[model samples]
Target chain A: MKVAVVGAGSIGLLYAIRTQEAGHEVTLFVRREQQIELICNKGIQVEGESMMYDIHVKNIMDISGAFDLIIIATKQTHVKKIVELVKVNEIVAPLLFLQNGMGHIEDIHEIINPTAIGIIEHGARKLSDRTVAHTGVGVTRIAAVTMKQEDLIIYKQMLESSHFPYKLENDWFEVMSDKLIINAVINPLTSIFKVVNGEVVNNPNLFRIAKKLCEEACDALGKASVEYHLDRVKKVAMQTKDNHSSMLEDIKNGRRTEIEGISGYLLKRANDELPYTTFVYEGVQAMQQMDRREYE
Target chain B: MKVAVVGAGSIGLLYAIRTQEAGHEVTLFVRREQQIELICNKGIQVEGESMMYDIHVKNIMDISGAFDLIIIATKQTHVKKIVELVKVNEIVAPLLFLQNGMGHIEDIHEIINPTAIGIIEHGARKLSDRTVAHTGVGVTRIAAVTMKQEDLIIYKQMLESSHFPYKLENDWFEVMSDKLIINAVINPLTSIFKVVNGEVVNNPNLFRIAKKLCEEACDALGKASVEYHLDRVKKVAMQTKDNHSSMLEDIKNGRRTEIEGISGYLLKRANDELPYTTFVYEGVQAMQQMDRREYE
Candidate 1:
């Protein structure tokens, strides 16, 4: 199987390496020419292991070949642009988007490719352009947005290994909301507090705040299964205890956060004002501009 | 007039130094005996001024001599215990408590000494045991919690000078509520985000969070004048632009914060749940216990 990953982020790097290790031909398409050079030179360094894996790399602009599957591993903020790039490149391969929020995913019914959305339970942190640490090893769950669920099984098989498993969810909305609520609860908090993912649940006071975020996400997204979502959030938080949330890493590294897609999306979707979500959305936003004195 | 400030904190040191400079006999009472030795050896250092003022200092445990006025410049958490010490010492001086929130100020009516509560608009940060930088120079407003407002004038005169001035407010509830709402808005955000006071208003994104906090505070405290309070918050934030909030300084210095008095008190006072307040209250509380990974 020849797989093309659309972004050279932590998630993209992880998937590209793992799939390539499973004896599948994997090509990682990065936005920058410099990144391709970096990857081609340094190969892909995985944490806790000495050998850097040599994976194929290409500029996203020069995406020239057909592949078995295309994984959009960019942030939720980049979904529309990536999809537009996909359409222009005339690549009609089955597309799997691994993003945080349900941003632009539901609206992509008009896209050319057979699209699917995935919720990656694993945590990966990119140390550099060509290095990614697979911090937490968990299964990736995929649901077909435009593709049939039966057709997704083969793509899942192509990506899964003995260590990296893949599961299929029946409903795209259900699966995405489950991931969204958890991301909404944990990501902003870990970023704002500079705590690890598990601190959201393990720290009792932090857990109380995380519960409020979960409640707001549940209410605003119109999820009736509150109890189940809350339990799932707790479980994932505990599972990824040591992983610094991507948003937290972004803030720490001075990168633009995907708040607009995550909590900000929930704020726009809700009928009523989600105070807790808004607080965190604004909290993270404020933190971006924080400590730099505007006047004297 | 002989003035004794019961807490040798920033506020206490500022008041003691200023009163002594105003040609009033001033004695600062401190908790730690080491603080007295530090002050006795080094005198008191104020920011922006080089000359060290020789202010008298004594341990809080000994309240032997008589004084014309006693100012309780301790934290809101230490109010009750400080008031008890006043009773135990039997030094019947006109008492004035300078602190944040309405924590135990109203309850001090049972005390024998004529008591007044003051809202110190000036910002001060304790740099060391006996040194405080006067960050903002706003007038202190005194209102009688148990004593008559007419009777507070002489004590105010004793503390006021050309540089340090005090004002008398007819209604303590209104003035204190004004301060409480502002503190509730500014303190937690600055502490959480680690920003100075001005950024709460100067930074537009931060101002949004500040507005939500202010709105929730006004609603929780039953203040119908929303627009007025919001304006006051903005004004105070801009006025203290360069000053780090006391709570922010405390958090940075790894000291205990007074979240319980400000947002915690408002949470208990409100009939309905204050999500914004709870989020920030738990935010500060969680931050206190944060980053200390519990398991693994």
Candidate 2:
């Protein structure tokens, strides 16, 4: 089986290495030409693992050939661009999106392929252009977005391996919302406060704010889901205690964040006032707009 | 005129030094016995001044004598405690309160003393126990909280000098609200973003949030006050660009912030929903709850 992972980020790199370990040919798609040079030359180094895998990597714009599975692991902000460039034989290939937030769910209709929305519970971090870390081990859960049960099974069997496990959910909306709630709570709070993921729930002050965010997010979903979402938020935060959230890393490195897709998306979906959501949405946006190093 | 300035903080030290420079007998009432010891032993060293004044400094608990003027230079959070401890001859010693926010305004009625609320525009930082740096020069504006105009004039003349000046406003409510609005926009934003006072407006990202905060603050005030308040926010932010806001300084040192008096006060007075105010209020509150140094 051939797997095409359309991102060279933490998740993309992790999946590319893991899928190859499962005896599949994995091609890692990256946005930058520099990442291509570095990855092809140095191969890829995964933390805690002694060996480096000399995996094949290419620019997303130069992607070609048939893939048994295509995983869109880019930040939700870049999903649209990936779809525009990498829409090759979508009818035959099963499209799986592992991007954070619910923004790409809207764009799933653009591909005529069998699509599945996946939530990567595994904690992964891109240490550098050619290095990655599997910070926390968790299963990948995918739900059929447009794929039928039979088609889903074929791709699931090909994608899931012993070390790189996968779980399929019946309801795509439910699983994605669960992930969305978790991301909405953890990402921006960690980003704004400049703390590791664990502190969001571990610190009492942050927990207070995190709970408020959870409640705001669950408002649209109704109160029934509040406890469940809040519990997941706390659990995931602690599970990835030391890892800097992707959004926090973005802010720290002066890159654009996924606030637009996470908190921003939730803000737009809620019918009533989402003061907490709106505050963080604008807060993260404000962070994206300024480079504090100049002041320093 | 003999003057008593309580609290050894930036404002307290500034006023104590300036009052002495005006040829007034000044006693600095500090909370810590250590501060009293330090100030009395080595005296205060103010930035840009060559001579160190061996000024009279005493513990706040040891406060005595009927001073001609009593100024509460403590934080708004400490006003109640100061009022509780130093309930000196309020009627005779015209008490002028120089603290940020309107939280202390409510406690003024508990005293029979002629009280005036003042907004200090001077950018002062206590570099050490007894040393302070006057980073920016601005006037002190006072409005009578309980005192009559005639009594305010006496203290204004006694306290104001060539280096330190004072202005009087007719309506204390308006001036205090204007200051509160400025504080609400500047304090928490600077504190949360960990930027200096000027970055709140000078940084485009922060300026966006600052504008929203000013609008939410002026919501109950109506549209007439929006531009005026925003212009003031920007002007003050730029004027004090090099200076860290008191709230920012408090957070940095792990000291208690006056968020309760500043953003917290405005939040309570607001009639409509203030997303920006509530966000910052809770954000600063959360900051108070957690010490990130443990995680560090």
TM-score of chain A considered alone, across all candidate predictions: 0.91, 0.93
lDDT of 2 by residue, B1-296 (tens): 77888888888888888888889888888878888888889888798789787888887777778888888888888889878775652335768888887788788888877888888878788889888999878899988978989888877887787778999898888888888888888989989988878777766667878888899877744447698889998888888787778788788878999998877777777787776787788788888777666334
Candidate 1 C-alpha lDDT tens digits along B1-296 = 88888888888888888888888888888888888999999889787888788878888888757888888888888888877788888878888888898756545776889888889878788888878999878899989877877678877776688788889899888899899999999999888887788888887888888888888899987899889999999988888877778888777666778998899989988998888889889989886765434311
Model 2 regions lying over 4 Å from their true place: A31-54, A88-92, A127-131, A220-224, A294-296, B32-46, B50-54, B88-92, B127-132, B219-224, B271-273, B294-296
| Model 1 chain A weakest 10-residue run by lDDT | A287-296
Instruction: Kindly report the interface RMSD of candidate 2, rounded to 1 decimal.
Output: 2.7
The candidate 1 chain B region of ten consecutive residues with least summed lDDT is: B287-296
Per residue, candidate 1 scores C-alpha lDDT tens digits across A1-296 of 88888798888888888888888888888898899998898898788878778888988878766888888888888888877777787888888988888777655776868989888888788788988888778889899988977789888886788899999998999888878898899999998888888888888888888888888899998987778888999898888777778788778777888888889889988998788899889889887766544312
Pick out the ten consecutive residues of candidate 2 chain B with the lowest summed lDDT: B85-94
What DockQ, between 0 and 1, does each candidate earn? 0.53, 0.47
> On residues A83-194, what C-alpha lDDT tens digit does candidate 2 reach at each position?
7765653336778898888887778888777889888888787889878889778899988988897788777787777777889789988888878889999999989888
In model 1, residue pairs whose N, Cα or C atoms come closer than 3 Å (at least 3 residues apart or on different chains), thus clashing, are: none
Model 1 spans with C-alpha error above 4 angstroms: A41-54, A291-296, B41-56, B291-296
- Residue-level lDDT for B205 in candidate 2: 62
lDDT (Cα atoms) of all candidates against the true structure: 0.84, 0.82
